[model samples]
Target: SLTKTSGTSSRSTSQLGRHFHHRTPGNFLDPEVRAFLEENTEVISSGNLTPEIRLRLLTPRCRFWKERADLWPFADPFWAIYWPGGQALSRYILDNPNIVRMGSVLDLGSGCGATAIAAVMSGASHVLANDIDPIAGMAMVINCELNNVNPFPIAIKNITDTKLDKWDLIVLGDMFYDEHLADCLHHWLGKCIKMYGTKVLIGDPGRPQFTGHSIHRQLHKVIEYSLPEPTRRENNGLTSSIVWSYQP
Candidate 1:
């Protein structure tokens, strides 16, 4: 079972309500995702409800992967919210199959293991999926199995941890929004890439922090994504996205 964090009064209690209230273009959760949640209903309802639980319960039901069936069993809501780029990157890798053949890959901030699974599907020799969120790690393990890929080793540790190993390719998905995270990831990614001859492949939806990286490939696939209606945040509509890959 997943652990839950304590919630403060400031947090809203409108998740189920928000899920049903919105009727935007990409509002409904994916059917397969919904099925996965329903299958795991017992686990989700077993513990004290918290933000993490709510997020996990909703993750497998989000419609961010309307364009890609390969991303089934979605892992994290924060990452799923920008899955267009992940699908685009996966498509790009599939098209250019040689880039991933037998390469050792590391998925940093691998929320839900979509990118890592995609890498393995595209021919990566080995993959290491790492995330700071324990639930996210569990999701990755489960999702990989669901996708028929061998469950790669998962580390529930931050990218900036003192004990870190190198890989031939580092795949980063939707982790560039926060300035601090982007900065720390950039530094560590550079070190890993340089030391291991690794290629850094990133999938981002044009967030501000994605500006300074040296881009090798930019895919122009515009995928429509539905935002979770309950968040009540800005940008809850359809948006265009891109997949940017680079070698540092």
Candidate 2:
């Protein structure tokens, strides 16, 4: 059975009332985080990939700084944007349902849970959408609701020590933005494949740090899409991206 973190799922209807609840005395859990995203972003279909589902995203006019000042610097709303890499992977899964259907799936660094939602929609038996950022987790929960899909478990922590054996398929979306992060994922994902037979898939917008020889040797492009200018600017002007199946 797929390992699950009990009671932490943001899917429960009961938790909807506590969206603005206080996690600490002075540190409220961005009570307005979901509302801010809904207000600022427009709901639209994902780029070529699962265009049937709606995603809440930031447009060029919506400034990230428009949010509360206290939440500034720490609040990275990238999850609110749909990147090319994620769109590619999601599209691939939809086109190839057997790859995830009836299997346990994990969406690592699952910002906004777009890939995770795709996995679930494709008939995955169980799914875990994990992100170290709590804000991102909130975005995932809300996004799931917008898409009218059941929210998967959202793990808000570094998942290096996770029970790898529990997952059959792992989907990583646009996580190779930094060299250190790229190196860590390269080593850890390789170990997951070697130790267990975990199938690893990745979506990248051609990052400089993503030079993993092992992955590149077996990497085959799955799909590609032309990202809008605003989205391109966010990704350093990279207009297109590829989804690849890692044969480690």
Tell me each candidate's TM-score. 0.60, 0.78
List residue ranges in candidate 1 displaced over 4 A. Answer: 1-82, 212-235
Task: Point to the candidate with the largest TM-score.
Answer: 2
Error of 2 at 119 (Å): 0.8
Write model 1 residue lDDT over 1-248, tens digit each, in one string: 11111111121234542342232313223444345444543222112111122113333344432324323333223432324445445555656657778888887777656667777888989888877644455556556555677778777666576755767777776666656666677777767766776677776656555655333223223333333333212233325445554644
Query: Model-by-model lDDT, in order?
Result: 0.52, 0.70
Query: Residue 83 error for model 2, in Å?
Result: 1.6
Q: Model 2: number of clashes? A: 0
Error of 1 at 198 (Å): 1.3
Residue runs of model 2 more than 4 Å from their true location after superposition: 1-31, 46-48, 65-73, 212-214, 226-236
lDDT of 1: 0.52
List the lowest-lDDT window of 10 residues for candidate 1. 1-10
